[model samples]
Target: MERILFGDNQFFAVNHISDEKSRAQAIKFQNDVEIIKTLDYSIDAGVHTFMCTTHDRIATICDYIRSHPAKYEDYKIYPCMPYAHKYANAVTELGIVGTIKEYVPNNFMGSLFKGGVAIMSKDYLSIMELMIDAEMKMFRNIKTPVIFLQNVITDLLLGLGMTEVLVAFHKYIRKKYDTEAGFITMNMPKLLDLLEKAGVENPIICTSINKAGFRMSGGKELYETVLKTRKVRVIAMQVLAGGAIPPKDAIKYICSLPNIESILFGASSRGNINETVSLIHEFDKQYQYDILSNF
Candidate 1:
């Protein structure tokens, strides 16, 4: 079976011996774990500010928390979205004790979103700090804080009513590849240019990478080439090559990647959580591989 790992940053799945359904199940498990953890943290932190909405899940969470008296919160409820007033009222009747937050429709991409705003946690802060420090050392410059700051500026131009015809000069270079199938290859500079044109700031980029028919030396060279451009923020993914690595091997290999900031992992149960945590704790950064041979 493929062993999965779930953490605050991302969910990762790797299997060399499992079927696709098991992978889907692993992702679902990760989603469930995150929800459960959210509630548990709220209760543990003694923060009564529980946010919920008309999504039918509010009731279940409320009942679950209420039934466990030791874990109850002061319970200020927010409709998952502002328009869910009727559902919000029903939630209030169920004994939740707070008003809903106001909403502006145009800013929202959909009628409802996961929380209508971005949620940040300690892990996120730590990762941001790590990125900043890494960029500083890599570039040896303090004025430019993020690696992708320039592109972000270009993307913002669209907001100023500038037409693409004037800015079409930005798309200057392109490249094609004939690498193995499933090998994720991205043109770093081009991607940053695109993100800039769209007004994207320093968002962390995530994508899958495949290591097939190549040794660790080949992988290292490929990564270094991308790194030199300073345009692409690269992170390795699909390291298991679609279940190409056995579960035990997946855990060890993933834990071994030194350049990886955090592996996105997914889980389905408490057992998955425990195993993942254990692997994280067991990671040894001292292990070194030739830049191209490790992958």
Candidate 2:
């Protein structure tokens, strides 16, 4: 994980703080040029990883990345999957059978038949793998070192106690994609335990890890305990608590924790990006010096 990851929430107009801002963003980012400009800003600020959902617009961005290999050579995208809206829209417009035909990998009839068999046999793991492949089709030929299972699916499987699906995703992503699998969840403590039980130790998990207890499930204290005691790649997101927390304090509180491998945040402008990045580096340097001072 990079020390900082540029997120795509701003590109997709997902403002948790205000619907008006979300609408403004939706209009502002309607063009791919705007999205690309922000990403270029991130690259300039020395952050190369763009963690984003697999939205339909992302396909256009991928096309741009594919064309400009030299420009984005040092960059990578951590694609979070099950972009629920994409699938919903596809199903609505294409219908069930058409949706399958549209998404099933080449040899459409064979893939569809196999999918049917998996459904009839209740081989959901197979179904899951197929869905992953379909979701990843747009990311072909791109550097995706870590793939994320969106929180909606992650927490759903958690709530259902169907954590074996988590293991299946881990294994399938590793075996098929040759990359690490990451899960974004609200309940980090429970998810970590289940991942361990499923034989996925020291996996990458992204969650809200702010000081205000904004969305940190099972409480911030438990998250701190797990970070201190357990071995996992922690990518802290929503550290700003959706604009509730100040950048300096948020970065300080999170970077001071025991095991945060990366911090994820989205900002539309270069100034915001530079400010947050600088704050993180400054606090991290202070935290390191403070640690050595205690010794």
- Roughly what TM-score does model 1 have, to 2 decimal places? 0.35
Per-candidate TM-scores read 0.35, 0.92
Candidate 2 lDDT, 1-295, residue by residue in tens: 7899999998888998999999999999999999999999999999999999988889999999999999999889999998867666888999966675676565744755767755535655775787788889899999999999999889989999997888999999999989999999999999999999888989999999999988888788888899999999999999999899988889989889988999999999999999999999999999999999999
**Candidate 2, residue 73: how far the Cα is off, in Å:** 1.1
Question: Model 2's lDDT to the true fold?
Answer: 0.90
Summarize candidate 1's per-residue lDDT along 49-158 as a digit string, tens digits: 33222233434444455465544423432111111334356557653311212212223323233443343222333322332232223212111111222222223343
Model 1 weakest lDDT span, ten residues long: 174-183
Error of 1 at 111 (Å): 15
Reference-based lDDT, each prediction = 0.36, 0.90
**At residue 257, what lDDT does model 2 achieve?**
95
Screening candidate 2 with a backbone cut-off below 3 angstroms (N, C-alpha, C), the clashing residue pairs are none
